[model samples]
Target: MSNVSYYTAEGLKKLKEELNQLRDVERPLASQAIAEARDKGDLSENAEYDAAKEAQGLLELKIAKLEETLANARLIDESQLDTSKVLVLSTVKLRNKQNGMEMKYTLVAESEADLKSGKISVTSPIGKGLLGKKVGDTASISVPNGTLKFEILEITRN
Candidate 1:
């Protein structure tokens, strides 16, 4: 079964662009490398040829995975998202219960997760715990060290 993921227009476009780059540019480069390596010497004794073949195999696997991901991706309409609670694509303002520190994060797909830009994957520990939480709701998220509590201050569609 294919796992379907939802993405905003920008994210979907980025995925398509990456898929195209892999197929059009990376695939040819892998093939060319294989050809060059094959011309070097005996197939059984050539380390370069073996390495090139392994690289090509890995490249093909990556391409296949990307293709499958693109096939299962769906574009999300941001305008239709609800702002009543923390949800996928919702920009949530949270206050760290223990430290009194405030931070904001946009819940996004796994592929689009970027901590620096405050976009987190919905599957992440904090994001998972924040799902369906309304304003003022406190979510206790478990991390590698310990459980941290975050109070949802606000939720908005961005």
Candidate 2:
């Protein structure tokens, strides 16, 4: 069974763009490569043709995966999001209780997770730990290294 995927508006847009590129550009290019390889030599022992066919198969697989993701995606309503507690699409500011270090992160879908941009996957340990916690609440999360505690400082939609 295919699990339904929840995506922010931006994430859904990105998936649509990728699907367009695959259908219009990559698919045609793959077909052209296969045709060119087929013209090179006999099909029985043609190495180029075999390689091109393999590449085309991989391209089709990618296209299929993207299509499936798009079909299963549900856009999240950004306007309806509440900042009362940590939730998906919420930007949370936290202070480490053990080391007094401050950090901020936005909880997002797995596909939208980019640590460099401070977007964390909702399924991630830290994000999971912070979920449903209000300001002034302390969360104890288990990390790969060890257990760490964080105090929720603030929550915002942005």
Give lDDT per model, in order.
0.92, 0.92
TM-score of 2: 0.94
Location of the lowest summed lDDT over 10 successive residues in candidate 2: 74-83
Cα deviation in Å at residue 9, candidate 2? 1.5
Q: Write the per-residue lDDT of candidate 1 for residues 35-113, one digit (tens) a residue.
A: 9988988889989888888988998898899889989998888888878988789999999999999999999999999
- lDDT accuracy of residue 130 in candidate 1: 94
At residue 12, candidate 1 shows an lDDT of 88
Clashing pairs in 2: none
**What is candidate 2's lDDT per residue for 1-158, written digit by digit as tens?**
89788899889999899889988998899899889988987999999889889988998899899999988888888789888998899999999999999999999989999999999998999989999999999999999899999999999996
Q: Which portions of model 1 miss their true places by more than 4 Å? A: none
